[model samples]
Target: MESPLKNFAEVARKFCAWAETQPVSTENEVKTAIELLANLSSAILATSNLGFGEDLEGERISDEEWRVTYNRFGFLPFNYYSTFFNPANVGKEEPVIGDLADDLADIYRDLKAGFWLYDRGHVKEAVWEWRQSFQTHWGRHATGALYALHAWSTNESIQL
Candidate 1:
């Protein structure tokens, strides 16, 4: 059987490829995004805790590049949603605005970093990159984006 890390890499690749297509906010695109995000989220969890590997430097994706990715999803029906910085502090704290585009872009950027290492025959490093980033970063974006996308999908009143 293939390793869980490999499985996650596959899912990440699929989601990244779809994002690279610069999907619009058409009904089909929305559906696809929802499904892919869900799949990616689940796949990420399956990797659980991975062992650390050699630390390798990778090229950083510039903010301008990220902005281009964000702009691609301009056709989305909604971009902003209200969420708490910490859900546990819900009643005590004010909700902050979360941007779906930002969530997607961050997820893409994090996964791509792991993909860079994995593609270069550094499986352990790639797994470490993914697991670490997931725990510290992309995991939050994935959940927030999933929640937002779920809201968008279930509401029939919101047109694509």
Candidate 2:
């Protein structure tokens, strides 16, 4: 089996490339979005399968970097949105503008932090940080983005 860290890093790289190059309103927008969502989802599963060694915090930015910019309508024709699911409001809906750029950017930012540590020979820190952020942050973004992309692909409403 491939190392989870490597798999995650590769996914991050591919996502970055896609975000940077994917044009607006492509003919196969749905297909591209589906593929991107699949990669992000796989990275999340890989994170879950990996162990949380050392339980240490990796380097984090006090202020996050700028949001990743991308072709807004490149992945989907319409703007997408979703919100955190609360058990108390299981049936209620709160929709925000959930663009693909923001979704990919969230995943990229967390992945970059871990990859930075890994590149600097802090392997343990990298894995620990990646897995931790996966649970607390990026994982939710991936899932939400998946919901949006899948809905777009199927011509259905974005259901959270």
Number of the top candidate by lDDT?
A: 1
Error of 1 at 141 (Å): 0.7
- Scored against the true structure, residue 135 in model 1 reaches a CA lDDT of 83
lDDT of the structure predicted as candidate 2 = 0.64
Query: Which ranges of candidate 2 are over 4 A from the true structure?
Result: 22-29, 47-65, 68-76, 82-84, 92-99, 156-160
**Residue range with the least summed lDDT across 10 consecutive positions in model 2:** 61-70
Q: Quote each prediction's TM-score.
A: 0.89, 0.69
TM-score of 2: 0.69
Evaluated against the true structure, the overall lDDT of model 1 is 0.79
User: How far does residue 29 in candidate 2 sit from its true spot (Å)?
Assistant: 4.6
**Residue pair clashes in candidate 2:** none
lDDT by residue for model 1 over 58-86, one digit each (tens)? 44577898888788776677899988879
